[model samples]
Target: MSTPTQKHTKSRKNIRRGAIRLKKISLANCPKCKKPVKPHTACAFCGSYKGKVVKKVRVPKSLRKSKKQEKSKK
Candidate 1:
């Protein structure tokens, strides 16, 4: 096993620890819903990707029936 030869200074240790801190993730807005979403991925709320619907997200059972009825009628 190997170890650092000299004891690290406070600033040097702080600088290294600061660099190891977690970076905040940046999100982009969904075009359809205008909600924040991770880039290059589908929107969780609207289930859209690049202006197209790529996935179908489920709604609560109470809201689901209304949408299903409306869709069946169309």
Candidate 2:
């Protein structure tokens, strides 16, 4: 029966558990659209993989931005 230990501080705990640091994710540039994407994956911007179209990729409606031209009525 031996239970006598000092309390650990927040900074000490964080330093001890430093494994939670974010790991860098490596991304390759898409040849078609020149966008950063994971290797061996289809380009989300151009819907192409390795210079060939593999699937249709579309931007979400919410995120899709378009400019509309307005004409002045005389």
Best prediction by lDDT: 1
Put down candidate 1 lDDT per residue, 4-61, tens digits, no spaces: 8999999999998987877799999999999999999999999999999999998889
Residue-pair clashes per prediction, in order, are 0, 0
Segments of candidate 1 deviating more than 4 angstroms = 1-4, 65-74
lDDT of 2 by residue, 1-74 (tens): 97749888999999989977787988999987788998887888889988999998877765553322222322
Choose the strongest candidate by TM-score: 1
lDDT, candidates in the order shown: 0.96, 0.80
Q: TM-scores of the models, in the given order?
A: 0.73, 0.53
lDDT score, candidate 1: 0.96
The ten-residue window of minimal lDDT in model 2 covers 65-74
Q: What pairs collide in candidate 2?
A: none
CA RMSD of all predictions: 3.6, 6.4
